[model samples]
Target: MDAPRQDAWKDEEDLLLATTVLKHIREGKTQLEAFQEVAEQLHRTPAACGFRWNATVRKEYQKEIQDAKNSRKATRTIYSSSKSSDDTPMSLDAAISFLKEMKTKQFEDYGKENLETQLKKLNEDNEKLREELKQWEAAWNEMDKLVHWVREKRKSESGV
Candidate 1:
């Protein structure tokens, strides 16, 4: 039998009720007891008090769940191996000679890893740009089609 408010429950009232409910629960009161007390104090039903309590607490736990998921991803290790195309058999001396020549011809490339990473980033950026371009082109094409249709209708109506 409380007066109806133009807006939803006020922030101060919600915080006060939530604090009271949490305190009662922390003091070893059952949820039912805490809910009843909060419901009476807030001039709301038991269900409404329970709903608000759940909304407030659920948000906090949801954040914690997301934090745990992010931490798990950060702690994981990724491994990858490159494939080689050599399938022919060669003598040990020839293999060693080829390896030595290959190593010498290729400068000690400290930047190889960096180059590959940059290439991957560039490829991803290119894909994003391509997608945006496609969307823009589609929108422009639709506009052009609409304009042509309108012009054609106008010409027919004018008997040209």
Candidate 2:
């Protein structure tokens, strides 16, 4: 009646999970979305991922989380102060445009990060392929040498 062992999180997985959670927070999206995405990538349950993030990863990034919260609070204060002074709220169009701009910027930043990750993975794959090719080449050369040795032995045995 022993319990099964769970897989440990690697550094790369932890980094990705942390980044995804931070991105979702910046975008004002639910943590569930981040958890689901990380879970799918890491082949873990969303609940497990979420629990790990809250229990461990979140604490590690306390400064980052606090900074984001402070930045948001400052933005809200600025907006509130402006509204109070003007006695008028931001127009619907202006608010929508601002939101659209923020979304676009977030998307661009995310895309850049994704590209960098992909490039790193591709570079690693390329290095692995090169090593495999070198091994194959060495194997082929050894086989060729063996074939030549066998042919020479047969010729000498046949007196040719």
Candidate 3:
């Protein structure tokens, strides 16, 4: 009793939009800020731009958010290689090493956060793709039925 379906390309557009928004949100920006910026830039509504921030995406970025907060705090301790040499102050090598260590720590934390966010985004994308595939299959099936019905009707009318 339902009407036949037509070809629809919904997922492709959704993917493009989703990826763009996800990239922005992952770049250490707030969801609302990213959404608003992306939406305005892309000439889209905020709601349409926000579909990428689903539960799955939120869960993925949650850890990164915590890590970022932790990373911002001072974890470096200034140590002078020649402690007795107060006049000389900290050695250049020691200062360099300490700075490198701090940089390394910040990088590692950000890397982990970024990785988790990307993984979550990938999972959400996969889910959306699967849903789109299902919709396509259903639409194809409906179209096939309609075509067969039309063929049968034409043959019968032509006495074939």
Candidate 4:
């Protein structure tokens, strides 16, 4: 008897898995919790989801995961150390400043990616235009030669 094949992971599932894991980590929750949540949504076993995340998805999103961890740690440290009202506001200000900086950087990175994609598309378009121009030039050269040949043949046949 043939064994049933396992279902392949979709891109959306991978994305959801990664984000859920990151969310759990940032909240100081366990991987098992994240796996359970993802499993319910994806209709897979929690163990299977955990294995997939640990083996592949986590590696692919290591940088993002680390960033989330660092952000959460910084927020925790700021809140925990603030005792007085003045210190509380100062810590809040620092957190706000950090958030603004992150937002700005995210926008800058997005803009750079957009520009690179546009540049690549424009280069492709320019190459296509160059090829078309070469074809048109060849056709014009052939027509010019034919026109000259006909004129000489007419003159010779007319004894001019």
The collision pairs in model 2 are none
Relative to the unseen true structure, what is the Cα RMSD of model 4?
15.5
TM-score of 4: 0.49
- Against the true structure, what is every candidate's RMSD? 23.9, 20.1, 29.0, 15.5
Provide the overall lDDT of each model, using Cα atoms, as 2-decimal numbers: 0.63, 0.80, 0.61, 0.83
Q: Put down candidate 3 lDDT per residue, 1-160, tens digits, no spaces.
A: 9765453214554455455545443333356666677577667676656665562344555665555434333212324232443454544544565677778978999999999999999999999999999999999999999999999999999999
- Output the lDDT of residue 93, model 4: 41
Model 3's TM-score against the true structure: 0.38
Better lDDT candidate (2, 3): 2
Error of 2 at 88 (Å): 21
Cα lDDT tens digits for candidate 4, 47-78: 99999998889989989999888977776566
Q: Model 3: which ten-residue window has the lowest total lDDT?
A: 73-82
Task: Please list the residue runs of candidate 2 whose C-alpha ends up more than 4 Å from where it truly belongs after superposition.
Answer: 1-6, 72-160
**Per-residue lDDT of model 2, residues 1-160, tens digit only:** 9765568777788899998887666544578999999999999999999999988889999888777667545544554343556545654534554577678878999999999999999999999999999999999999999999999999999999
TM-score of each: 0.32, 0.43, 0.38, 0.49
Name the candidate, 3 or 4, with the larger lDDT value: 4
lDDT of 1 by residue, 38-109 (tens): 778778888877787677644644554455445433322110112435454544534444556457646456
